[model samples]
Target: MKFKKQIFGFMDMLRFKKLVPNRREALANGPADPLPTEYRTNVLAHRLHPGRMEVELVDAVMVTPTIRKLTFRRTDADAFPFFRAGQYVSLQSPVGDSLVSRPYSIASSPREALENKLVLGVEDAGFFSGYLCRDAKPGDRFVMSEPSGEFHYETLRDKKHIVCIAGGSGITPFVSMAKSMAEGDEPYEMTLFYGARTAQQLAFRDELDALSAKGLKVVYVLSDETCDGCEHGFVSAALMEKYVDIRESSFFLCGPQAMYDFVLKELAPYDLPRKAVRKDAGSCGNREVSDPRTFRLTVHVRDKVCEISAQENETLLTAMERAGIDAPNKCRAGGCGYCHSKWVRGEYVVADGRDGRREADRKFGFIHPCVTYPASDIELIVPVGE
Candidate 1:
């Protein structure tokens, strides 16, 4: 009986082995493409992380002579992605024959995005701003990337209290934060030191005043003119020390190049932790080009070759746009690495501290054209736009 049982067990094992699928046979019979799963077909995930969305300008209000508040609403999608208060969206615009993209910090709270509205406070300065302010209308269509940036406050990384230093249009992001905090979306104490030339140049004054009444500390510092109730001076370390406990707080800065230069120098004596100081990725430092001559630029995109004249002071991205070439770019500040191209030939000058390329990228002769200026006639292999 034991022998019979042993033989039966052996037979059962053999049958089980035969029923198991063979690896090679399974591979040969598998479908050529993967079938979509619930994870891949999720609607909420796609809505929250859509790469780009089509939006139309619904309203435009002039905040100041140089600043305009543009309101955008989604055209095709049901809603815009929810973004942090300090993140910015890149708006793509066609200027003449070329397409250009620029990032603007959202001035509205995250709740506003849920209502299908995004507000941008644009200051007329460069080519893109000129188009947005002068040429764009109420019904003009635009393609905007999802909100992105590393300028927002985080409870895990930042302290409970924050000191914000803003200049010019830089005050927009802080406005979003103030609104969010007032609405109970964010739980952090904020004190904003806003700098401007005069009272007339201060954008979003009324909105900020309302938020200030709701517990946001707002200090207006005027450099050129002093009001009866405003502080008269730049945002200096002395002024910051008067309001904030430097050792127990985090500092956030958003402004033009000159303001960043002066403010960072002013804060250096505090010897704060590296993580304690955060500057908006959009805050670009000043770079001077000694030469003022035009150089030849040869760009290779897929099978097409584009030749354009580049100025010594302007970036390669600017030259391509001027020539009506729609080159891809985001965070024009050089931190996003979206406009990276192969340097086929020629010399270029990358601003110091603006080179965010990886070590391997630098070693292999790749450069981000957004912040790379032509030092001489240049040749590049630019990636084709999707």
Candidate 2:
């Protein structure tokens, strides 16, 4: 039976009078065990987002003359955290006097990651890459950052059909994407356009073809040479129109600066919405100068401060790496903001089109060491490496 307001008020006051007594009685009768020192939620979170992992190279094969497909297994854990299909991981190892790291897209599917297997496609174009491609053998240990990147598919922001364009070693992420689609993890239909100089240079031709039979669309485009049943030209808009309506589909591009320039120029005429296109960032390399000068670089990692020599044409992150200082970095492309540090004092400049810092970060004197070069003797407070 419902009570009137005045009766409810009286009942509440009577309950309040017995509240202390009731609480004491319940406490006395409660279980004697103490509260848990750890939580289940915290344990699951740590398992999924382990920031860094120690991995061992288990296998390495030359997919092409220049690119090597390397497989790794985590030494610290039995299984790696599952990641998005198109995300990347940064691998770090000491090469000679310098401690170097580079970001490479994951070529294995996320399902394979759960089985403690992950793969990377490394092109032997740089000093560290050459070492990894040729010298690194099975059983060698390396530090691997957990899969991290914004280069994956999103259900809300992207369309159902995604047209991917790759040049040279840029086909790495699409390998994972196709595998993920075949595994029923991703919801998007993938159409890949892989462009290379010749038919033999097309890495993963057999694997991509096998996936194509499983519903993924594959197009092999050659520029210098062609074979039977392949598109014989660059990956132009005109060529794409023959198979898919690019304007109605989202685009994912990964390649060199020249390829990006060409594809972007081709799409400019369509006046497509900016969100319709997604391009993976390329790493920043040393600037070309006739005569480069070395300047003093003072770095502060926590309370320890060290001064080293930095080159005028190199980035601050490069100087830190050459000095064997473990400064935190991921993309090394000035994007991701993983290497953002405080600018203590320096005459510096961010690489063109590589500045990914927020406006508030710029206003607060934050700098991304990965893309920033020392114009003069410089000083910075770098974050401790993960």
Task: Identify the candidate with maximal lDDT.
Answer: 2
Kindly list the per-residue Cα lDDT of model 1 for residues 1-386, writing each as its tens digit.
99999999999998779665666678889999986666755777888878778999999988988999999999988678888889999899787788888899999999989999899999998878878987799999999989988889998999999999899999999999999999898889999999999999999999999999998999999999979878999999888888888888888888887998998899888888899989987624235767588999999999999888998888898889878887877788888888899999999999777899999999999999988988899999988765
TM-score of each: 0.87, 0.94
Candidate 1 has a TM-score of: 0.87
Task: Supply candidate 2's per-residue lDDT for 365.
Answer: 97
- The regions of model 2 sitting more than 4 angstroms off are 1-29
What's the true lDDT of residue 315 in model 2? 94
Point out the worst 10-residue segment of candidate 2 by lDDT.
1-10
Distance from true location, Cα of 297 in model 1, Å: 1.9
